[model samples]
Target: MGHERVHLLKKIQEVEFAAVELQLFLDTHPQDQRALMEFNHYSRELMMLKQQFEMQYGPLLNFGFSPSQYPWRWIEGPWPWERQY
Candidate 1:
């Protein structure tokens, strides 16, 4: 993987963390519109980043979330634990 991909993955992790935190907060404060908005914003950002990453590399998911140019690209890369990033 390249530097840019690592950066994007890190960003996705950060955004996902924030979204999960907001979800927990919303669980206690279901009436809080502000927290809901923030969660939605982060979710959208995360989706876009995931899409970009998949386009440049391969599917981040095990299923067919993102299509690949090569049919077998999904199994071509190093396993997740083997990746340096």
Candidate 2:
């Protein structure tokens, strides 16, 4: 809800988009090492951002993803559809 949270979410979206695009490229050009490296870099960035967001805000997923804190904090935050972005 805050500006910082919004910015981080935007960054995560951007990195995820890049990763998807690189994946598509690699699907056709499987031997392109450069694309593979770029995909890995973006994947790493996305993972870090997701971890940071989860630590500060809450789990971004409902199950089988980020570890929940004590008292089950995953259900404590706003649902994705309820958020204003």
Candidate 3:
């Protein structure tokens, strides 16, 4: 909901897109080391983003929801579809 969270969410979205694009490319060029490397990088970033989001915001999925030091305010925030992005 703040500037930092917004920035993190944007980065996570970008990484997600990049990973998906790389996946499509790898489908045809599975032997391409460059594509593999990029995909791994993006995947790592995406994982980190997800973890950070959960730490600061809340679970990215319903199953991941957990109680934090304070009440999980993120549950009250937008669902993925409802988020402005």
Looking at model 2, the pairs that clash are none
Q: Give the TM-scores of the predictions, in the order they appear.
A: 0.84, 0.89, 0.77
lDDT for position 17 in model 2: 100
Please give, for residues 1-85, the per-residue lDDT of candidate 3 as tens digits.
Answer: 5667778878888899999999999999999999999999999988888888878666667654544446655556665445563
Name the top lDDT candidate: 2
Candidate 2 C-alpha lDDT tens digits along 12-49: 88899999999999999999999999999999999999
Q: Clash number for every model?
A: 0, 0, 0
Candidate 2 Cα outliers beyond 4 Å, as residue runs: none
Which tens-of-lDDT digit does each residue in 1-85 have in candidate 1?
6677677778878998999999999999999999999999999998998888778777777766667766767886754324475
Query: Would you list the clashing residue pairs of candidate 1?
Result: none
How does model 3 score by TM-score? 0.77
Candidate 2 C-alpha RMSD relative to the actual structure:
1.5
lDDT of each: 0.80, 0.84, 0.79
TM-score, prediction 2: 0.89
